[model samples]
Target: MRLILASTSPYRRELLARLDLPFETLSPQVDETAIPGEAPPETARRLAAAKAAAVARREPDAWVIGSDQVAELDGAALGKPGGREAAVGQLSAMSARAVRFATAVTLQRDEERFHALDSTLVRFRPLSLEEISRYVDAEKPFDCAGSFKSEGLGIALFDAIESRDPTALIGLPLIAVAGLLRKAGFALP
Candidate 1:
């Protein structure tokens, strides 16, 4: 069976490559606006499933993988910064605070589906304005939800990280993905 990834994120694509699986990527053109009253985890799960289903509609025979991530701080969801100023602001606000990154993954083929949600708690070390500015300028993590990339220089900004799967922070949960693929009869080992 052909494997497809319903996303345009390079980070997720890179992670999936680690599994040594040959997968094609398609951009899932789904609206990502958060629904009112929807929790962070729910948002991630809903988007992930929507992405997979969108691609599954196009390629019904292929196994499609979709994933989404949301960074939550004080009950509010933080999306991609999109700019250096916004990234600096996000990092400043996240300074000395605990943010929960909820990453959800969905795999679908025909009428069958599998889902997994991984939550990672990242405690930001106390950051000064200069530090935030420098980091933002250096890494330019404008496309990342938390305004940082744990796999890169962003690790220096964290005080502690708590998660069952460390890859979740980078955007995909390989452990969960492996289990789901195994259930779907993929030779993961």
Candidate 2:
């Protein structure tokens, strides 16, 4: 079966590659703005489906994978920091706190769909301003939600993480993705 990933994120692409499947990648190019008052998990689910649907419209025969993640602190969503100052601020606010990361994934083929949502709790250790700055300077996680990369130096800032799938924190959940693909009739060991 023809397969496609409805996003251009390198992280997602890398995670999918671990499945050892031949697939094509496309930019979903959908607006990612969260609906006002929408919960974090809802935002993730909506965006993931939107991304898959957007690409499925173009390639009706191919199964497309779409995924999105939203980091929630105090009930509000945290977005990609986008710059140094914002990264620093986000890390500071999250210091000594437990943040929830809601990640959603969708598999779409025409009108048919399968979905999964993974929730991860990241407990950030109490951090000093100096530590935040040093980490931000070292990792510059400007493109990641929650202002850190769990796969990289950002792991140092966390006291603990609780998740069914560790890959969810990196932007894709492999276990969920594998299950969705298998349900969609793809072969996996």
Candidate 3:
């Protein structure tokens, strides 16, 4: 069966490429707005499923994979920064705190559907404004949730990371994705 990734994120695309499976990418075009009183995990899961379903509407014959990540701090969800000011503010607010990254993945094909969620805990070190400013300037992670990229120089901002799948912090959860794909009859060595 043909495989399709329903996301435009480079990080997710790179991670999916590691599976060595030939797949095409299509923009999901799903609204990512969080629902009122919704938990971070649920938001991620819902978005993931929505993305897959959006693309599946166009390609019912292909297996579509959709994924999303949300950074939760103090029971609130922190989305992408989208600019230097927002990135700095997000980093500052998250300094010396533990943030839970809820990454969800969904696979859909015709009547079949599979789903998974990976939660990664990242503890940020106490960061001064200068440090946050420098990191923001160097990495420009404005488009990334949590205002940092755990796979890049942003790793230095964390004091500790606890996760079952390290790649989940980057965006896509490979371990969970592999399991879902395997259950869908895809062979993976």
Clash count for candidate 1 is 0
Computed on alpha carbons, the lDDT of every model, listed in order, comes to 0.96, 0.97, 0.95
Model 1: colliding residue pairs: none
Cα misplacement distance, residue 78 of candidate 1 (Å): 0.2
- Show where candidate 2 strays beyond 4 Å: none
The C-alpha stretches of model 3 lying farther than 4 A from their native spots are none
Summarize candidate 3's per-residue lDDT along 1-189 as a digit string, tens digits.
799999999999999999999999999999999999999999999999999999999999999999999999999999999999999999999999999999999999976899999999999999999999999999999999999988889999999999999999989999999999999999999
Q: What does candidate 2's lDDT look like per residue over 1-189, in tens digits? A: 999999989999999999999999999999999999999999999999999999999999999999999999999999999999999999999999999999999999999999999999999999999999999999999999999999999999999999999999999999999999999999999
Writing each residue's lDDT as its tens digit, candidate 1 over 1-189 gives 799999999999999999999999999999999999899999999999999999999999999999999999999999999999899999999999999999999999988999999999999999999999989999999999999989999999999999999999999999999999999989988
How far is 149's C-alpha from truth in model 3 (Å)?
A: 0.9
Worst 10 residues of 3 by lDDT: 143-152
> What does candidate 3 score on TM?
0.99
The 10-residue segment with the lowest total lDDT in model 2: 6-15
